[model samples]
Target chain A: MPAVAFTVVIALLANADIAFGQPPGGRPRPNLPPIPPKGDTTHTLTRDFVPASNTKSETAPHDNGFIQRWLALEPIRKEIQRNNILTETYIRTAFAENNFSTDFNVVPKNGRKVKVGDQRLQWHALDSKTFIFNLYNFTYAINKPPYGNIFWLVTVINCPEEIPNVRMAAGVNSGGMFWLNGEEALVLSGDRDMVVDNVVSQPLTLKKGKNIVRAAIINGPGMCTFAVRFLDENGSPVKNFTISYE
Target chain B: MKPTILTSLSILVMLATQTSAQIGQPFIHDPSTIVECDGKYYTFGTGGGGLISEDGWKWHGGAVRPGGGAAPDAMKIGDRYLVAYGATGGSSNHKGAIFTMWNKTLDPNSPDFKYSEPILVATSDGYEECDAIDPGLMLDPTTGKLWMSYGTYFGYSRMVELDPKTGGLAPGAEPVDVAIACEATAPAYHDGWYYLFATHGSCCDGPNSTYNIVVGRSKNVTGPFIDNVGRSMLEGGGKLVAATEGRLIGPGHFGRIIVEPGIEKMSLHYEADLDQGGRSVLAIRPLLWKNGWPVAGENIKAGTYVIQSERRGYALELAVDMVRMPVARWFNRSTDEPIKPVDTQKLEDVIGDWPSGNIDARIGDYMSRPHQKWNITPAPDSSGYLGAPYYKIVIEGTNRALAATADGKVITVPEFTGAPEQLWMIDQLTDGTYRIMPKQVPNSNEKLALISFGDSTPALGKFDVNSDNSKWSFRAP
Candidate 1:
């Protein structure tokens, strides 16, 4: 009877580990370098973002053309210089050499685990209720240090019809790179605050089908955030499309 | 009209000017035009935070504005709200930047509530002639173009165009000098004329502030705005719109709110409400347009008045059998005898004659009868609309209350139950006449005003500003 009770307890513990996407023994910790202490802790993490109320796990762009839904992978520790030495050359070279994923076009499933460098990170589906995504809050929410890390976000936009002459408008803090359908579309490399439509890509066409948008945001110190949207030739928001974490 | 009754109404008006202000914590400076969102009203002031009201009358502070700036203006465009404010400027330094942002919802608790990062639209260096503060936003109803007027007493007031879609500066749009010697400038359009409303004189001086609202009109949004007498606003010519009234001194920052077609209200702040400890407080008054120019209208005060229909020179009265007065046999009496004043018809003399049920109302000759005398008093415990409280129109000395029936008719009920149908909104129209509307019509959301359907008939109907049938005047009996 004591042996049977011990077996039952073992089964329950195994089920709990499986529920958290961990192996039976335990999840492996990321074998990454130690993270330095955060420089600033005075930032009032305003609970501005809320979970999207989409029942079908899909969302839409904001009325002002801001994309608010994304599937984010857990941050991977990275060495970054202070004083915003993050320039165009530094960011492009960093993103080019690091193979974060096997295929950029593939939209990772939420709760799925991925191995980047020596770190094993899980993917999460998040809906930013605000125009700008607060990366500090996002990292803190996932129990990870917000600074000195790289965050990878992916979203699938389903267009109703083929759209022409639409430009990708984006703003990001620190530095970031954007990809559309596995092709580099825009790169924002600077230490700056997020301003709406701060950098707009040249006019591009959106095919009448699912389009994958992926981004990698790198922050060395201070706050990190990003917002992206599509504007038509007339500069109005392209809101006819739907967003989902597929 | 009796001289004594006129004197009473005059006193009431004087008292209202000194006492009637927005209730609750309505303290604000340079309040923007009040905007309604999801049935709630919000108005942002000069500082950062603003006031929100479930009902327009009672205001308290819970509104949120991200950028702490001076003179913010808010407007709703499509499904989004655009907010523009000046970032910096004061008596010492005039260097400032005006920014615009978009928000999904003004209520902070809303799931979609978030403001787009503010984009700088206009700026001014201290060395420049103009200060880029005091941003007043106006969307041209005709062209769908958003325009902003900004500046201060430090330099020229200027107008610029903004992208209505992005809340950014319009492509290559330059600021055009519109007016000088004024700040807190706002633009309004009426009857094909674009009017530039601005605050003139000193501000932030409490009771001693010389601030007054003045305006000039032009045919174009990019205007050489001209006053009524053909003086250009660029030359500092502005027709006076509002000035110091009673204890509320320094009326500045004019914001116009159209309650309905014929009813409008102007929102401003009294630099010092002596009654409110000389603190700047929000005040809303009826906006009356006279001779193609806008002027501040008085809020109707609580008093006994004879409601006369403008359609016909007849009075609103209960449709009851006329009671006979005591016969003095004056035909045989001589003029030489000492005369005693004839007391007015008392409510007791005729209320017993009226049916205990609802009495239909009509327009008839007013003989100062008790039924024709309406005692309009602010209904207690009622959250009022916009600028004034909902009033209870009752017989002078009884509970017979004026109410709107489910059917499109006006009647006097036996008692004032404080029901929505019994509450009345008496708005002073632009023509100085009044349109009496119920707080709500029974079984319908349609807003109907008391109209003289015929010379002898009174009914609830659509308010037509051009027709005298929709107008009623409150006269002293």
Candidate 2:
């Protein structure tokens, strides 16, 4: 029994050594950079990245709700979804938690209606200027995976106005994505060989003090998993703020 | 009869020797005249006037003239020693001119030890009665130049250059405002660091006078110096140093360091009177240099004490209360689950002592044990508290106003009030528990005892005795 246990211990150590020696398998392995020294700010310095053209996923699912319906039915919808699937969740959660109906007119420019499920989620031409909405979630979760009981989400914030400098941090099992005002500000994806910073977003400089901020979160499915929080540069939650779906 | 006379003369000689040795050794009144010449020591301040110390500990009293100045700031240049005396002033231009006097030698036996007339270096130019109160001298090693600093108003201070030989201001040299306080007073210097030490808020008035010490530094002798946050000295920017924790009142008018070489100890002399109305007694405290700044003796015990004359080493201890979140409760998502507050006052293993005791101890004399253990741990959940570490211990020094520091931090109680003295010499009982007692007490009949931690959750095991020195122990309150 002692010899068997010793053999098992050796095997576990050998496995751990091999895992530590190489990067994880998945997407093409990019050039792995060295970790920065403690307190050194040079490595992994933050910057913004954005692309103009829409890049569609080669193998996207066909039954992914209204976004899927729009992609299958409308040529313009296909172009939009092909470009960014991250934005759908933001619009969906904003309407669902705010008790917004999908029956409202969405295209104020053309008087067109965009329907979600049986209701139209849109802004009317007459009420576009005064239209407002709110969102609240009873369940929130962001956690690491394998044994992850929560969700890992990726998001993008689209705003007409410039954002102010804010402290932004997110914790999750794998990683997430982010875009600010049409610009890709952060991309934290997949597991790496070593432990990494759970917070992957940088403190973004926004306009003076107040501005619009939108985040599109994509959470990996799991047991009892789902959550996203908006925080300021001081790592404080931006609470009681309003959100609009249209 | 002649034989009897001879015997009497013999006895007189021995008595004179003993008296000379013991004169300036005891605490003297203000109007101090002090000189550190060669190796001998001579000092006079407030009322007890002239006193001399050879070894810098034992003092023998000297003469106090009818009137001269409050107290003299002394320095030696080449062959002569110059002492700056505080006078009301001369012409209206410089009303606070602290007059300077020349003395060939500080030795009483020297024939050339004659005092000279005053040399007016500073005078008042304002109606607020700018008085040249506390004066400090510093020398620039790069150019071998001399500089002088003086206080004005309640919190304003300025500095200028004096000719090394003449002991007078350099021609065309103007006194620059080194720093200002909402209530700043005394200033001093060590190494190349010009320490603009001052007190803020109300002072001197009993019980009501809030006083505390704040300090800033500058690289240039004529400073546009800055504080920890880079705020300018002239702009009233400074970090706090010494302040009255509890009974310790108005600790200002700091004297130069009485450094005893070969003994890693530096003693800073200052003045403190009970409620500002009592007589000003010379207070001495052992000094610590942290990152090139002077921190007065730490772990001060609270209570009444006669400050020791010799230099003593004080351990450096800093406590910052941080908010801690429990792992189990942090992830608990039930909104209705009442948020529980953390118990911050559990001091069991932490052990450190603060210098405490009467006016003597607070003033840098003999250190005591009570003020040493006067710990202030965190007390959270107060809507009234905000910023950095929310809780704090407020203080008032001799000539400065009242101020406070972060929570869970201990302060040196600056006065000798007969309150519940927190100074103690803690001893571990046989059962592994500890009890504290005062370092020294005048009344032998007065039995000393340790106060309980109150109904607040028991936190006695948070502090432990550091292995290096038993004189100081880490304590949590």
Chain B of candidate 2 vs. true chain B, TM: 0.52
Worst 10 residues of 1 chain A by lDDT: A1-10
| Candidate 2 lDDT tens digits, B294-353 | 565533333222222111333221222222323464674899888887653222312123
- Residue-level lDDT of model 1, residues A4-48, one tens digit each, is 111222233333322111112332211112223223333332243
Question: TM-score of A-chain in each prediction?
Answer: 0.77, 0.29
> What residue pairs clash in candidate 1, if any at all?
none
Poorly placed runs, candidate 1 (over 4 Å): A1-246, B1-25, B324-343
Q: Which stretches of candidate 2 lie over 4 Å from their true place?
A: A1-246, B1-34, B38-40, B46-48, B58-60, B63-67, B89-94, B107-110, B127-130, B182-192, B206-209, B245-247, B258-278, B298-477
Cα deviation at B247, candidate 2, in Å, is: 4.4
Please give me the total number of clashing residue pairs in predicted model 1: 0
For candidate 1, the per-residue lDDT at B120 reads 88
RMSD from true fold, candidate 1: 26.6
B77-131: candidate 1 lDDT, tens digit per residue: 9999999877653323345678888998888779988999878888765444466
